[model samples]
Target: MIRSINVSSATLRHGIIHSPFRLVTKPSNGLRFCRVRPLSRPSRPSIILARLYSDEKSPKENIKPTELAKKVLQEAAKRENIYTIPNMLTFGRLLASPVIGYLVVTHQTSWALAVFGLSCVTDLLDGYIARKYNMQTVVGSVIDPMADKTLMMTLATCLAVSGDIPLYIATLILGRDFLLFLSALYYRYISLPPPKTFTRYWDFSLPSAEVRPTTISKYNTFLQMIYLGSSLVFPVLSQSITIETAQSIGMALKGLEYVVATTTILSGLSYVFSKDAVKILSKPNGKP
Candidate 1:
């Protein structure tokens, strides 16, 4: 005779199927089972579990392009423009150039001199900042000197036109710049190395055999700055000093101009006599 067997509900829920051919009964264990039913519908627990896992997996696939762009922009915004105190000062001088010109033209001598002096301070501070902070950039190298030239040229032109300086002085300074500019152009066109000015300062060492600035060129730039500063200051200072004293100052400024002109000519001659410069100049027209 066959006897009924008992099975736990947990086993049925877990989808463990048993064959109905035999049964063993033990009254001490409290387990029961009804007639086995074939599963007509899919297991609800398994379906729910699959849906939970699929939902968890979708977010990685759903990340859109817009989200990536936002992330990139956020990273970019965190980056900083390099800053140095000296460079900031130099930038201030650049901004002050027009103010100085306006004061000089309006006969505000004291104010113009003050502004010019501030610009000089900025120029000095900028170099210090660059060296101290190690925040130099290619843009700074070009822009710094360009700003200096602008201020110097503007002051020189104003002084020359106003009869404070001789026209020849202005012409000489500007002419040297022009010649150097043309040489730079020639070098660029021939694919030769660029001019070895301050921009190339990093490439050479002390006592190195590189084609570098002649001492005369350095002296020329120094005198140019001196004359520029003096010319800017004289008109303002003249208001306090007697005519003869002012004339003496003017004579001294003119002497500086002559020195600058002579040094400039000598520097240009040195570059012209350089073997590399001669080779570059000898290149055929239309040759790249």
Candidate 2:
């Protein structure tokens, strides 16, 4: 191997990185000082720029650009836009859940029906507004379904206590929600980065997992809402109708009860079997 301290003007004009040279602290080309200002990313002619600064260790080796990009994409979790019209509506429904349940339990049939109707309206409007106005958010995704579940559970429990809906159906609904809640807790803990404190676990801003409701689950929610809603309406209508018509409505409701029960079971199983139901956002090792 030949080593030369050639630093000629002509050699520089052509290219200064051709021949073998010893690993000196500085080039012998009289250009002893090198000021490597950080560059965003250089355009084409990548080889020339890299060779000119070969003295500076290759950023590729120390800082893998591919790995950096992948990390960015992985950590690119959506910021929680907790304040939004849709989320506000969802919150409203959540508040109304207890109100509606209390009204039902207290035998305020008319008021309960009114509040439940309002809750359903918000439920429909929130989703539509989120989609049309591009207000879809990560928190919205979470709270929307959460509000629905809360409302459904409250209503189911209330109606069962009032003997409007079957105990078996209520039991099924509560069981499914209980299992899902436990699953959610497990996923959240596993996905949360290290140093997980009580505060961090509850922080929606640092979302650790995503819950994707399955198709059957969605339909089940809709059916359950209808069943619960009809239960509220039944008391008011049964007052205005004849005994024969009341009996017929009761039979219809019984059949609906069977349908809702089947859907609830299927929906619960769907979450268990489906691959995309609940996704863990980060690893236990704190890598996103």
Number of the predicted model whose TM-score against the real structure is largest: 2
Give per-residue CA lDDT, model 1, range 39-123, as digits (tens): 3344544343333333333534543445544544533332334355655666777788788777777778778887887787777
Find the 10 residues in a row with the least total lDDT in model 2. Answer: 4-13
* Per-residue C-alpha lDDT of model 2 across residues 131-163, encoded as one tens digit per residue: 999998766777788899999999999999998
Q: TM-score for each prediction?
A: 0.53, 0.72
lDDT for residue 207 in candidate 2, whole number 0-100? 74
Number of the top-ranking candidate, with lDDT as the measure: 2
